[model samples]
Target: MKSHLIKDVGAKLMNRGHRAILAISGGRLLSAPFGMPTVELHTVGRKSGLPRSCYLTSPVHDGERIVLVASKGGDDRHPDWYRNLQATPDAEIVIEGVTRRVTARTATPAEKAELWPRIVASYRGYADYQKRTERDVPVVICENR
Candidate 1:
């Protein structure tokens, strides 16, 4: 599948449904599915300055640190949430019914080189997503404050 099609499915369907379920279940559902953790990331809009929330699966999680990929289903443009983190690295994430403050940063190329295989091992779709796009997908590390 192409990047745009995947993006559309996420932006238009799955994400919305997932967020609704998570909210309705009070952070109990839609988290750590099949042992892979998912967090609700809260970011400020880069342009609007409004708050935005995105649900993302973390391929790597240790203690209070999590790694997120700004793949947007391999879309050409980075997801708005990732751009928001770029403009404002300070953010919050909801994990397992708790909200924690965090700081975000893109991993360096060397870091990505070491991390990529581990990440793809955790979730194979990311590797497929990379194959679908020409841009280098960003790997963002969000650390607890």
Candidate 2:
């Protein structure tokens, strides 16, 4: 499938209302679609300078912090949101219907080493995603700003 198509479909399925169907509502979370926490990440468009948003799954989260994978479904290229965060790390995230400001940063090699196992444990697809591409899939850590 085309990259844009995958992103479009994913965005649609993960948005607020539809996400409720996947299991999160009014600060309460249940069993999510992939047994992960759902988050709406807001960022500035790197090229357009416009606000952009995408729904993502947090394979690791501790209420105050969130860890995201830039897997792009194992595509060779990084996802737009990942690039956006690289360009502008200041962002906002909404979890369980509550929004908060955050600073986004790519995990260091040591951090990745420690987090990788837990990440894959949360969702086995991450291991598959890493194996499917030659480039190292980055782990993004977002913490309250």
Candidate 3:
């Protein structure tokens, strides 16, 4: 699968708010282009334990080692998912139709500086997103099992 195709299909799914499915499918499409599709992570709320899902892009294998940015479309407040991960680093991820347990953590300042450019280079919108917010965006790294 090609990245452009994944992006196209993903854009369609996202427009319809079918994010989970989109992520699942997109991850498969990313196999050849992006090396492998990232897993779609679903985490339970620390307080409520309710399920929450997000599409993640990884620079590693099957989201086994992944990084997420707290762009939140560059909003002032951090994304809710970021807070959720903070409350509980333990989470679930679905990759290529398989689900697995994983851990999540915020990257250190130095790590973020080193990784941010790579992220921006891969997804240019991130740089644009930064321009919209005043607070620094956080970079989250998810380690999968």
Candidate 4:
């Protein structure tokens, strides 16, 4: 399937009925299906100046912060949500039915060096994704705003 199509459908499914399904299924529905927390990220479109959101899996969530990968399935281009966050760092993230305000920023080289191993350990696919593209995949850290 096309990436954008998958993204749009995923956002729609999560927004429309996935939450209810997750609740009814006792947290085993889609929660951490990928060994990571699923997060609904809310941001403002940089150009449109309108609300934009997408469901993403966070590879690391250590209570104080959540980590997102801008891998875009190794498509060689940054995801729209990633770009949005670049333009406007302020955002909201919904995890386990709780919403929190956050500020998003790309990890520094030092931070990435420290976090990359843990991130890859959480999901090996991310490492493969990184190898598939020339551009470096950005690791985004979101902390309470």
Candidate 5:
């Protein structure tokens, strides 16, 4: 949980590796052996104004809507995708093999308090990730755009 080179490097390696696989497999093998569903978040870069995407697990979704945790594996800083979404809420999400346009927003404090437990219940790692950081990790909700 503490700041350590191994954890930092491992996280980067895992993300990069997972991203590569997703690109190669065309979303068929997202997140590999993890049974939980993973989705591709497409956000316009805040700085470059270019399309960027990263994979994330959806701990909660209701057919038309999905919730993505900006936990950054509980790191102190927000993930780039989350930051980009803040600058440009217009985005896209690829669930399974279907891609759809979406508008994203960080959940309100009241909503975070309401959804936290349900998310943690779906994936225990999210709770552990929070313990590793000082900041309240953001929760992003992406609905049909």
Candidate 6:
């Protein structure tokens, strides 16, 4: 199957919440080296009351929280999944072969100010992405449950 199709299947399986952890663990084993790999984030559709999944890079982590960026590669529009999270802060993240429930919130200005530099240091592409857009990209904190 194509990557997107595979991701969809994985997300659907995860939503069942049965053996999701096992699936995620397997994914981690398969995808690691190239910085934090992509994971399927299962979020609720703001209006549809159904699950939506998207592929996003896993950035740095602090304590129990994982950071994600809504960069969209500096595209003019924000990512759909980011918007969904804004509507409903509760979401599920599959990271490093583990699945966990998390509450998603945008970083506060102070938090962003502090965290953005760290992010750019770890992932240099972020700085280039910033230069491409007029609006500042948001850094989302996914606090684990």
Scored by lDDT, the top model is 4
Q: Indicate the worst ten consecutive residues by lDDT in candidate 1.
A: 1-10
Displacement of the residue 98 alpha carbon in candidate 2, Å: 1.7
Which ranges in model 6 have alpha carbons more than 4 Å from their true place? 1-30
Candidate 2 minimal-lDDT segment of 10 residues: 22-31
Candidate 3 lDDT over 10-103, as tens digits, reads 6546634546445578644443334435557787776798997766555434335677777766767786678898998898877667777779
In candidate 2, residue 114 scores what lDDT?
97
lDDT of 5 by residue, 1-145 (tens): 5555676677778878888887798766665334567787888999999998777789888777889999988778888888999999999998777788999999999999999999888889999999999999999999997
| Candidate scoring better on TM-score of 1 and 3 | 1
How does model 2 score by TM-score? 0.82
> Could you tell me which 10 consecutive residues in candidate 6 have the lowest summed lDDT?
13-22
Q: How many clashes (backbone N, Cα, C below 3 Å) per candidate?
A: 0, 0, 0, 0, 0, 2
The best-first sequence of candidates by TM-score reads: 1, 5, 4, 2, 6, 3
Of the two candidates 4 and 5, the one with more favorable lDDT, higher being better, is 4
TM-score of each model, in listed order: 0.87, 0.82, 0.70, 0.83, 0.84, 0.75
Model 4 C-alpha lDDT per residue in residues 1-145, reported as the tens digit of each score:
5976877676567556766766698867787757788898999999999999877889888778999999887877788899999999999999877899999999999999999999999999999999999999999999997
Off by over 4 Å in 4: 1-28
Q: Model 1: which residue pairs collide?
A: none
TM-score-wise, the better of 2 and 5 is 5
After superposing candidate 3, which stretches have Cα over 4 Å from the reference? Answer: 1-16, 20-38, 59-64
**RMSD for each model, in Å, please?**
2.8, 3.2, 7.6, 3.1, 3.0, 6.4
Q: Indicate the TM-score of model 3.
A: 0.70
Model 3 worst lDDT window (10 residues): 27-36
Query: Could you give candidate 1's per-residue lDDT for residues 39-100 as a string of tens digits?
Result: 88999999998988878888987886889999887777788888899999999987766788
For candidate 6, write residues 13-131 as lDDT tens digits: 54455345436776544354337655668999888979988666666775598899888767555767888999999999887657889999999999999998888877888888888
